[model samples]
Target: MAKIILNRENLFHNLNLISKQAKGIEKVAIVLKDNAYGHGLLEIAKLASEYGIKKAVVRTHEEALKINNFFEDVLILADVENSTYSHTFHIAVNSLEQIKKLPINTKVHLKIDSGMHRNGINKKQLKEAIIGICEQNLKFTGLFTHYRCADELSTDFYWQRSNFEQIKQEVKSTCEKLSIPTPKFHSANSSALFRVKDFDEDFARVGIATYGYLETDTIFNNPKLKPVMSFWAQKISTREIKKGQRIGYGGSYFAKKDMTVSTYDVGYGDGFLRLNEKHKYITPKGYKILGRVSMDNLSINSQDEEVCIFDDVRQLAKIHDTITYEIITTLNPNIKKEII
Candidate 1:
């Protein structure tokens, strides 16, 4: 079976960098959505907690419940529960309608669609949202907005930041007029946090950077972060292929000369990307993958009992024309993860 190994030292190193950029560890909220981006929720949560992290961000209330014991604050990005509110859980109010659905006395962070216009309420609806939050008896604790292209070299980031600043001021004034406590403001993710020279936020909702993959453009002087996860697979069987013999489903690969090959127990079925023979994928150790990747295995020219599928996914993501987030998050959660 394929397995995942997490580097504890690398994780701590990344967190240290994030903490420095965030101005302090207290200002960092590790994003644990989608099973810690498929690095194993419980596994990463334990490590984060051990590293003195106090806050976490997840996609659902259900995910928060699993790691509540690991953090002082758990922010649910997109789910609300009717159950009694706990100080440990804070839901993000994406819409006025969502505010109405939240239980009375539930703590929430208002998400403003400053410019991304994806989730969150529009900036124009600020007063309406405040009124709803007050009327609904929800506790407004924070306000945040997502950047659309903070990683790219574009002026859009500045444009969005300017918009969020306006929204923040409006929120503060409206809260003051309504006699509501001033809510904390945060507008940076991993990329945006690094883009700015000054780090001033209640919390930076850091995701990929915490796991050691910064996606900023090379033109920017991005910090060098170490990858925390490595994937490995065990050899299931081995055989010798004679010269001129074909291999795999469509016979897309044939040995020019005799060579020893082994099928490794890792494939798309286990959330790994399947490669066709035309691409000629090779392992980090320089062993060539011999044929089309199978549903449960792939033949590689190696006899080692265990082979490293990837220690870092950036190159693999480039080969597949996808992002590192997709590459890591697509990994099957069922795979065992060990912190080294």
Candidate 2:
């Protein structure tokens, strides 16, 4: 069976890196939206609590509820339909209608559309949403925006920041007129938190970086981040093949020499990619995955009793031409996870 190991030291190292980047912020809101990016939601939440993280962010009310006991505040970023806001769990209001529909006195955060255009109220609706929040007496705990290209080497991030600045000013002015105190504001995600030095926001929402993966590498200087997750699988069976013999379902690979091969309990079913010749999955010991990967297992040229599937997620992500977040989050949650 496959297993995942979480290094507590590595996790803390990553968190410390984010803390250093968030020098002036009051708090760093750890983002645990996807089961702590598949590191185990409750597990990571408890770890964060041990490290004194006061706030966290998740995608749904269910996820927020799971970790509410560990953090002082848990912000629900989406799924407003099932959300019942409270002092501990705050809902992010992306639209004016969403805010108006909220129960009176429900804690909320206003999400403004700076440039992502994915979720959040546009500039045109900003004023109306603020006014409605005051009229309805909703607890406006925070206001925030998401940047579309904060991870890329582009100038668009500055533009988004400019827009957010204007939106913040508008929010403050409107709150003052309505005799409502201005809410805490934040917009720096993992990418912006490291890339943008002048991000003097109330809070830094650190996501992928908290889990030890940087989305962008173009930025010249960066803090060292230790990967926290390591995957391993034990050999279930072993066999030897002739030089000219074919292996696996498609017989895509032909043995150039008689060699030993072992089947491990991991494959696409376990979220390991069924890679082809162009992007072959290689074991840490330099053994290549033979032929097409099966649903339940994959064959590798190794005699060892166990093998490290992946120590650094970036290797798998590069081979799949995707991001590290997808690689880690796609791992089957049922796989036994051990915190080291």
Candidate 3:
């Protein structure tokens, strides 16, 4: 079976950098959604807790429940639970309709659409949403927006930030007039955090950057965010092939010269990308993947007992013409993962 090696040192290092950028460890809310971006939910959560991370953000309420003990505050980006409410869990209210459905006394974070338009209520509905929260006796505790182009090279990020700033002022005034407590406001993501010359948000929800990957343009001079997870596969078998011998499905690869090749216990079924002939990928150690990637295995030009498939996903992402998030998050959750 394949395995994942998580570098504890790198994880801590990334967190340290993020903490400083956020101004303090308490202000850095680790985004643990999607099983910690497929680095393993509980695994990353445990490490974050060890490193003094007090807050977390997840996509679902159930995920928050899984790591409730790891952080002081768990913010659910979506979904809601009406049966019970705890101060530990804060649900993001994406729309006015969602605000109406939350249970009484539920801690809610009103997500302002600002500009993303993917989720959250529009600025026009901000006052109405707050009134709905108050009417339902829900606890309004946070005001946040997502930066759609924060990771891209565009002026849209500034526009979005300006929109959020205005939204914050309106929210403050309305909340004060209605005797509603001031909600914690945050909008910067990983890219936005680095883009800001001065870190001043209540807290930043950091994800990819915390996992040792950043997709910003060259202008940011991104920090040294070391990749925390390295995917490895054990050698299932090895063979000496003659020159011109084809390998794997459809015999897509033909040996130019006689060489040793080994099959590794990982493939698309394990959430490893099914790389084809055109997108040649070489391992960090210089082993080349040969032939078509199979569902349960792949052939590599190496004889090592265990091979590091990838330590940094950015290199792999380039081959796939995708982002590092997809490369890492697509990893099989059932694969054995251990902290190094």
Candidate 4:
């Protein structure tokens, strides 16, 4: 008894809208990292490719292979430790070891640390790393980095991107001597590209953005973007609750007085894992979320009203004390996701 509906139309629009943000680009890589951020890789990525999305990015080496079977043209941006010599898809390599060992003819990218403290080569070691790779000729087709901040304009963000400038200069000089196209450069993620105009890159590896989500006010303020995923559920049952009646597990909620109650056939197991008592729910006809969320069920105070589950993720997260990413990614198959 799942009332959830996935609006394929909105999803498509979201992807298109985000992609359109990159003006005059010959090709754009639709990031499919994290199973397309839980939108279902096979379905969403296939649709993206069908819509002429020429490229895509994933997190791990295994993920690259998982999508490659379906998307032969996927442009994988993560490192593949076990990849063979002629494997299809671009890879992001970190250090001298990878540059030395990676197959010479493979299409791969050299990633710089930039200041995220997560991955890539450090600024101090940039020139040395580039020289080593160019000398060995590891098919250095691209150079990129991850933006630590695009949600806020602060010193943290500045220093992170500053390294990109430094690395870009070094790599450009080396690429010229090695006779490679100034390895197409890219660094900004969703929040950066959508929010700050100057933060644009040759190619932005967008995941949440394509799904119609801008992490902060900077991008959400952009009237051009739209919410692609409108999550919906149905109000299966409604009844009146008497005073003093305890609601849900552990008696977490109790009726202050006689009131209307509704049941939604989804709970924590169904990706409704909000432990907050003030969480809300929306049905095709109305909105509410009443008591403790169970493994396969949750209660909502329906005042006999109805709304589709196809509301905004922002609303659900407000009710659940979590984030939009968690709500969407954590949703289990316990609730059906049908494209509308």
Candidate 5:
């Protein structure tokens, strides 16, 4: 079995800590989208529910259909095209057809296309559309938009935040004046979760922030969070190569001098994302990657010609210019992953 490890204990701590910063909040709709960012969908969802996180946000209907029973409520957090599960939990409406297809009694959160310009209803368009939804007689509706640079505390982000606020205020006023149930007012993701100063909101769809790494380098040193996904691998075997010897596929690795290479059962297929050959993967105690990361295995530089490859998810993530999100989430579940 392929060796992969996970740390769930630290994860709970990260969630509780991040929640404290959100001033006024009753529900923490933990973002379970992207298969819980590849941290194992069912497991993390259940864990969240166990830890008191009732609501979860999923990308498509398939993800929602997986563990709807475990969480308190599910929100199709994206504009999923498939209408097969229209009767399922609330969905985020990005277009008119989606809004039109929503169940008569279905509750949905409106996605306002703010300055982000990615996938939301424009401010004016938002106001009109939401009003139309109510007029058309849909179930329940809440308004929410995504923040593009909520993590980057720079001038560019300032503009985005400004526009976001204006839209938020307008939506709030409309919801209040027209009694439209004003969306939960969630314009923040992980980016806005920690760095947006005092973004007091009714609810926050916490995702990567809840998983550990903010997925952004906004804050470092004494940061108020801890990494939750920790991986472990074991050294299967070791060998000594003479000078001028070659290693791995295509003889990409050559020993200028006598060298010892440790082999591991990890490769790009395992979500290694083999970038240039000189990438790294970790061993149980913390041995870095060495040589080419092949489709089925990789080598590590070890001094004693003897090494241990237990598991270390972070080390692998570091190789691909990523955190646990990309690495662990991309990991093939077919491989053996045990939670520690």
Candidate 6:
């Protein structure tokens, strides 16, 4: 059977690195949405609690409920509907309509659309959103924005930051005028937390970096992060095939010469992909996957008793032409997760 091995030491190292990067910030909210980036929610939540992390971010009320007791605050980045759970979670108000719908006195983080245009109220609607939050008696706890190009080498980040700065000033001034206490402001995400020197905000909401999947050249060049998860599977069977013998569905691969192949207990159903011949995946020891990945099994050109699928998701992301977050989060949560 295939299983995930989590290195607690490596996770601690990455958390420590994040703390160092967030030295000047008032708080560091670990983004645990997507099941802690597929590292296991309860497990990583326990670790974060033990590490003295006081804040966390999730995508839904259910996710926040799972780890609500672990942190002083759990901010829900999405699903801002009024519900019984609204009182327990700090909801993110991404639009003026959402602000109006929130229950009275519900805690919220005002999301200003600096430039992402994916979420948050537009800059033009900032005043209306703030007024709605105030009129509805919602407790404005924080103000924030998302960066669309913080991971890339582009000037768009600067423009977004400038717009957020303007939003910050407006939020503060408007709160003061309405006799409401100013909320804490934050904008830097995982990439901006490291790349932006002016990230002296109330908190840094870090996600990918905590899970060891940084994508920026600036962070990668420094190399302080360590991947925490390693995937492995045991060889279930082995066989030798003659030259020209076809393998797997569609005869996608043929044995060039008499060679050994071992079947392992992991496949696309386990969150792995059936790569085509042109993008054959390799094992840690450089043995190639022989053919199409089955739902619950895959064949590899190796006879080892066990095999390491991957220790870092970046390699898998590269082959899949996607991001590391997608690769790691796709890992089936049903697989056994062992913390070492």
Q: Write the per-residue lDDT of candidate 6 for residues 1-340, one digit (tens) a residue.
A: 7998889999888888888888832378999998888889988999988888888999988899899889888899888457756345789988777877877888989888888989888888877887788789889889999999988888898899999888899888888888888998988888888886545788999999888878886633454789989999889999998999998999888888999888999999988866766776777778888888888998988888889988877777878899999888998988888899
| Residue range 5-27, candidate 3, lDDT tens digits | 99999999999999988889989
Between prediction 3 and prediction 5, the one with superior lDDT is 3
Q: Go through the candidates in order and give each one's C-alpha lDDT.
A: 0.90, 0.86, 0.91, 0.68, 0.68, 0.85
Distance from true location, Cα of 128 in model 6, Å:
2.1
| Residue pairs with backbone overlap in model 3 | none
Of the two candidates 3 and 5, the one with more favorable TM-score, higher being better, is 3
- Arrange candidates by lDDT, descending: 3, 1, 2, 6, 5, 4
Candidate 5 lDDT tens digits, 120-206: 677768767776678657754467777776655466666766777787787777778887566666767776667656767667788
The sequence of per-residue lDDT tens digits that candidate 4 reaches over residues 149-268 is 667656676777776887788878877876767877888677766665544567777777677676665524663555555544456688888999988888878788998887766667
Those runs of model 3 whose alpha carbons end farther than 4 Å from true positions after fitting are none
4-55: candidate 1 lDDT, tens digit per residue: 9999999999999999999999999999999999999999999999999999
| TM-scores of the models, in the order given | 0.98, 0.96, 0.98, 0.83, 0.84, 0.94
**Runs off by more than 4 Å, candidate 6:** 24-26, 86-88, 218-223
When superposed on Cα atoms, how far off is each prediction in RMSD?
1.1, 1.5, 1.0, 3.4, 3.4, 1.8
lDDT for each residue of candidate 2 in 1-340, tens digit (9 for 90 to 100): 6999899999998888788788832469999998889888988999989988899999998898788789888888886574456579888998888877888888889999998889988899888888888788788889999989988888899899999999899888988887888999999889888887665888989989888888876654667788888988889999989999999887888999999999999988988777866777777778888898889898899988889988888888888899999999998888888899
Please tell me which model should have the higher lDDT, number 4 or number 6: 6
| Best candidate (score: lDDT) | 3
* Candidate 6 TM-score to native: 0.94
Question: Per-residue error at 312 for model 4, in Å?
Answer: 1.5
